[model samples]
Target: MARFICGADRHQVTLLPNRLDDYVSEDNPVRVVDLFVDELDLTALGFASMMPAATGRPGYHPATLLKLYLYGYVNQVTSSRRLEREAGRNVELMWLTGRLAPDFKTIADFRRDNGPAIQAASRQFVVLCRQLGLLAGGVVALDGSRFKAVNTRDRNFTPAAVRRRIEQIEASIARYLAALDTADRQEDEVAHVRKVRIAERLDALRTRMRELQAMESLVEAAPDRQISLTDPDARAMATRGKGTGMVGYNVQAVVDTEHHLIVAHEVTNVGHDRTQLAHMSRQGQVATGHEALSVLADRGYFSGEEIL
Candidate 1:
């Protein structure tokens, strides 16, 4: 018989032959993630639970969760649930976190509670990048991209959108009323069934109209005359495609064209890019440790007020 490749027996057992570090290659990006997070001062950066509680069960350290968060950022795994799963299964993550797998809620709460601290940590990372000469180009491309928020279009109310919704409800109510009139002119039994259904639909339309009217006041009071029920901080912004719109945040990034790495970024509820030019350029300059930087941007960044 011809020899064929063979596999180890399923029943075969051996001593712990491989260390966690052995599974992670030396040049893996997780090595950088591990090193960077170790150098951060969580307490000074405002992360909570740096010290163990006087009386309670122990919790995961801020640094561990922060490392996991950074790993997700680099790998593009934004969901906490996904991170938890990866920590339990992925070899690189297991090595990075030292085989400790905190649940998804813990991971999520860590991020939620340490927002400002994380921002400070991010600035520190930019400083480190500058030291490494990653920002040596001294020139950056400034642009804004709309990031979709948790809010849905149905839950978001723009002044014009809500007005249209209210008008639609009124139209539906009018049509239902006309149908009810026509139903009344029919035979008694047929009219009774038709009237009952029409009445129910009319009530629904009336209630919807009242709700939209109430939301109109809130939308009007907003700076942009828009209100999102799910995510109040998000705004309705038009995307790149024609007639396409989304209720989301505007993510402004300044990237060094040579390296194609983001030098600095800001998230805002502002929909337009017109006013963010000078502000983002200043951030890039500071991050790169330069007095000023050469900036290139599309016409979207042009603003008369921001120029001066």
Candidate 2:
């Protein structure tokens, strides 16, 4: 007989222990991690720590960092802090890193320290594509997009322009300081607030100008890795649209004509696409070992010498 108000019906069924060992096996993203370790030579590539030591424990393996980065890239969680968080929760990341979750600092340091290694890894994928017959004739599309940078727009400066700006800001600051002194002497609170505000604005301008100056110095000192407080190495580039420009790097890719697979790729801190056509075509020739290849790109990539 059914109860008049069926509110008391309850049941507790015993659940079996299902370890992750069964579902998550060798044929997974973890396999990519293992392949990276076995195929690539981290030591030769200038990786900091490749082998585990006696006294000190080994650092996170390149495979782990690679997997972490790959996962982060796929998920658009490029930030190390966000990747660290994802590592703990994402099942795929858990398997890739072998249930280990390194902190954000470790993750970020891995990228900062092993920029060359990561670039090599990306190149290796192209090699793999070629080997798999996925890249027959290496012709690629080249384009660039602006990913957000840590630097503010104000931090950017040209050497000559920045000097003039700094001089002007300093003059303004001096004037504001003098005005503040005069207002204090005359017991004028309203003028004092105005002067203080002006001083604050001047201070901000000075800070930004100083940062720009330092960046200019770095640009002269080390052309590569010169920090752009907004986005280090991110060039001010134009987009593909009719009249759109974006502040970003030029990303190049070599696509195979046969299989349409990318055989080579490079990221450049260049604003114009005119120069990239020949460079990328040369890279495609090298990667494919072909004398000639057909390349199709937008008008932006067109050049007289490049066509030749």
Which of the numbered candidates is closest to the native, going by highest lDDT?
A: 1
Instruction: State the lDDT at 13 in candidate 1.
Output: 84
Relative to the unseen true structure, what is the C-alpha lDDT of residue 295 in candidate 2, on a scale of 0 to 100? 70
Candidate 2 backbone overlaps, count: 4
lDDT of 2 by residue, 1-308 (tens): 57666554367566644665555667776566556556877677667667667687567876678778877765678889999898898777776777899999999898998898777776777777667777664455555434544455455544544567678877877887787677677656787687778778877877877876676677667554334556766644445695454455656776776776666777777766688888887887877767877677788778898777
Query: Residue 280 deviation, candidate 1, in Å?
Result: 0.5
Q: Which residue pairs clash in candidate 1? A: none
Angstrom error of the Cα, residue 21, model 2: value is 4.0
How well does model 2 score by local distance difference test? 0.70
**Per-residue CA lDDT of candidate 1, range 25-137, in tens?**
88999999999999888889999999898898989989999999999999999999999999999999999999999999999999999999999999898888888888898
Instruction: Evaluate residue 214 in candidate 2 and report its C-alpha lDDT on the 0 to 100 scale.
Output: 70
Overall lDDT per candidate, in order of appearance: 0.90, 0.70
